[model samples]
Target: MPIPDDLHIQEAATLERKAFAAMESGHLAFRQGKISAMELFLLADKWELAEEALRCLEKTAQSS
Candidate 1:
């Protein structure tokens, strides 16, 4: 039942990545004034994708 390292996300990795990307996008949306501060304040608490989302944000900020 062990999935090979190459087969990672054979279960939920795909969903996790998509979730992380989506949540990170929320931050950008808020930063660009697309979403209100109060909106992020409220929805941020509901986001469970912190670490990965931050990682994505860091990369994006670095690239720009």
Candidate 2:
């Protein structure tokens, strides 16, 4: 069965949010002195998120 486009979009959005949350948690852990915590964060980033984060950061820097 073919999934509807709307559902696909919704699912992608949900996954992206989860990935972002994981990355954020990893960063927090890293800041708090947990080096190994970054692995989980990167795993999420690998799911088409790290590029987005990097782009956003770059844009912010450029605008500043």
Candidate 3:
């Protein structure tokens, strides 16, 4: 398997951070009645995906 470059790892980290921020925003929106429960769930999924991607990249980087 090919190892991820520094740029790829950096991008993955940034994506995870943005996903977390978006999830937090979604929670605030839900609390304020600005978004539906389904929307919040979708944001949670997005965060999970980002988190997984970052973990995979980090693991690959470490192994290589």
lDDT of 2 by residue, 1-64 (tens): 6555555455556656776777777777777877665575566548566457555545544454
> Could you give candidate 1's per-residue lDDT for residues 1-64 as a string of tens digits?
6445433333245546666677788899998999998887756665665445545655544454
Model 1 worst lDDT window (10 residues): 3-12
* Model 3 lDDT tens row, 1-64: 5645776678777877888889899999999999999999998988898889888878776776
Measured by C-alpha RMSD in angstroms, how accurate is candidate 2?
9.5
lDDT for 16 in candidate 2 is 61
Q: What's the CA error at residue 26 for candidate 2, in Å?
A: 0.4
Model 1 residue-pair collision total: 0
Q: How close is candidate 3 to the true structure, as a TM-score?
A: 0.78
* Top-TM-score candidate index: 3
Candidates ranked, most accurate by TM-score first:
3, 2, 1
Predict model 3's lDDT versus the native: 0.85
Measured with C-alpha atoms, the lDDT of residue 20 in candidate 1 is 65
TM-score of each model, in listed order? 0.48, 0.56, 0.78
Per-residue lDDT for 54 in model 2? 51
Question: By how many angstroms RMSD does model 3 differ from the true structure?
Answer: 2.4
Where model 2 places Cα greater than 4 Å from the true spot, the runs are: 37-64
Taking all chains together, the TM-score of candidate 1 against the true structure is: 0.48
